[model samples]
Target: MTTTGATKKVLVLFSGGQDSTTCLALALDRYDEVETIGFDYKQRHAVELGQREILRQALTRDFPAWRGRLGFDHLVRIEALAEMSQSAMTHDIEITLNEQGLPNTFVPGRNLLFLTFAAALAYRRGLTYIVAGMCETDYSGYPDCRDDAIKAMQIALNLGMEARFVMETPLMRLDKAATWRLAETLGGQKLVELIVEATHTCYLGDRRVRHDWGYGCGACPACELRAKGWREFKASPSA
Candidate 1:
């Protein structure tokens, strides 16, 4: 459980979005070895997988010290999960508010499954940490993004696997604006710019349009939150 004076290895549940990219930067800064894993669950925003690869290359080029230490970038195909889920993120349906007032984009059991699989992968690879970017603030009302849910999932994962794997959620309480600030603090202005330019957060999967915040369709919940966060961040003294 303790990683003092020893090489700390971590597996990041990367999604190639602004939040996850920031988490990756933080992992690179804190851990001795870092590897990233992304899920392909046939989501509408499949472009994120490509963005993950692009960011990985850019990170490797910018932070050459992580060249060898950054282990293999694994992209797991879980299309069966998508087929079983009926969320707007996976199915070709209009996004709406569910009866529970949650966004239709909420995929049930996604974070749970993702962490479980990541924990297994980490155990097999001799890693003891799993990093994720789930945030409760400025989010789309996804229950899995909550801190308590993640904590329970972490406990469950450890108990189920009989491993002491730590699940790290660096953005759990961070708002979008605060997330931007964290990235800037962790990797400087270059990283902030990289995220704004390269990361994908649009649920509609529209990348042709560019905004001061990032690329998105500008109407989806994800884009609205990102744009609002960028505006607030820019107005704050930190910007």
Candidate 2:
């Protein structure tokens, strides 16, 4: 969707990961004003939380065009969400699929709650769009990340808040490799390098060893997907 005039503003659901970082870049490119919001749910990879500020600083420092458009960064603490889940992401446990076939890393109602809170923040901030990094093409099988779920959330938020808020998920259909290509398309190799060096996606929160894709334990689902995508992206003819 095209946005113009004062309404060309967005609030990104940024989590300092590759997907959210790419989405942030896209929002800055497409919108006149852009704000970001992150959550601290006391996850295992809380290190990702720390990377948010560093990534924001790098974006404004390296990309001059996005500097003025980038606005406030809001962080919310909802520890109760983690307390309600005993999943691997919320606790120190194995990242395995449960009997229902969904991975234990799936924190139930995460995206739902995130969007609800984000819509509320956007309402107060006078933002028109809510951009997120949720993807279903190459994900851990989280139901909330699906397109239909996002659409439903948009309707619910708009109806509940009595405001017209558009939800944009740029990575909804793109896989990990395509997501990397999107980063390059948005900000060239500089953005890709920034993502590799700065963004954190490992579920285990291990950053000691640095790989081409970034720091991770290399065994968790997150790292594996990132590694595979990086390799595929590098192998692509255009890359």
Top-scoring candidate (lDDT): 2
Q: Per-residue lDDT for 4 in model 2? A: 53
lDDT of 2 by residue, 1-239 (tens): 58755558899999999999999999988888899999999989999999999999999899998889889999999999999998999899888999899989999999999999999999998988999999999998999999999999999999999999999999999999999999999899999999999999999999999999999999999999999999999999989
Clashes of each: 0, 0
Candidate 2 matches the true fold with a TM-score of 0.98
Instruction: Provide the global lDDT of candidate 1 against the true structure.
Output: 0.88
The whole-model C-alpha lDDT of candidate 2 against the native structure comes to 0.94
| Cα TM-score per model | 0.96, 0.98
lDDT of each: 0.88, 0.94
lDDT of 1 by residue, 21-83 (tens): 999988887788999999999999999888998898888798765566677888888898888
